[model samples]
Target: MTTEDERMARFARTPAGQRGYDAAEVDAFCERIAAAFQGSTMLTAAQIREHEFAAAAFGHHGYDRDQVDDYLDRACVDLEYARRGDSPHPGPERLSPRDVQRLRFSAPPPGRDGYAAAEVDTFLDVVAATLAHAGPTGLSSQDARAIDFCPAEPGGPSYYADEVDAFLDVVVRTLTEQEQKHTAS
Candidate 1:
């Protein structure tokens, strides 16, 4: 089997003229990830989930951002399961209040259609508050499912709809699990 170093060495580079993550920074972080897998480092899944790298300098090609992010997501999940001594494959994990509070979505390119940023942020605030309270005085999973944001005005600031929607799925599952636990007690 290929080692982590070998796998990361093959990460795709951004196209010429396109900015991407700083290659050196990503490589350093990947080294930490590899160390974590080997039990030589203390990197946590949350750290992996929240890690960010600077953009490559002008005229420098960098690793593809999307590719790195997807790999990090899988790595985060794997690390979490590994810590739990569980199966390598895991379902979506629940989020804590802090996790919800820290969530962010990338904006679409200028002039592209997307969800209004303010609406999504406000809703996340409510979700975080609810989670912080452990299922009282907040929204239910169904409520979250029914929520909607206005379309961003043409050329205005907005969050990518797909990213927000995927995050909502996680939020809904978390809330649903909380509600079930609350009712069971």
Candidate 2:
């Protein structure tokens, strides 16, 4: 089996270019990831999966965002599964790769009409408000994290699935941790 050092040494460094992500930031993040793999850092899979760097619109060449993001996705998945295997918790699941994409949810079936735009929007608004802890009543941090939504009716004012999935994953993580604490206590 190839050693961790060997595996990481093969990482392709991104080229500097314009309109790409900041090379320094990307490199820094990769270093952290490598450290995690070497058992010297405590970074989590979610952190890796959600990592973002500002775009580099300044110079001639920069690290490619598509390549970086794809690589990160693979790394995050590998790390998540590895960690999950070590956890005592049952049924641990990782997010699907498609979950991060800007996907267009399918529309209503053949003859069926779309959901009522007003009601759908209202529901989404409520969810957003609750997640943001805006109103007097909202989803508990755990509920926010655990909550999942199907794609909105593919007609009027549909929300982006990728955005909602990402937000809800964060929420679920928060809520699940709280639940674990409560259970332990």
For candidate 1, write residues 85-135 as lDDT tens digits.
654533334566666665656776454578998899999899889887985
The Cα RMSD in angstroms, rounded to one decimal, for candidate 1 relative to the true structure is 11.9
Error of 2 at 120 (Å): 22
TM-score of each: 0.51, 0.41
In lDDT terms, how accurate is model 1?
A: 0.73
Using alpha carbons, what is the TM-score of model 1? 0.51
Tens digit per residue, CA lDDT, model 2, 53-98? 8876565466766677655655554454445453221211332223
Residue 63 lDDT in candidate 1? 88
Give the best candidate by lDDT: 1
lDDT of 2 at 116: 44
Residue 2 of candidate 1: its Cα lDDT?
A: 18
Summing lDDT over every window of 10 consecutive residues in candidate 2, give the lowest-scoring window.
Answer: 88-97
Question: Which pairs of residues collide in candidate 2?
Answer: 16-61, 16-62, 17-61, 17-62, 142-175, 145-171, 145-172
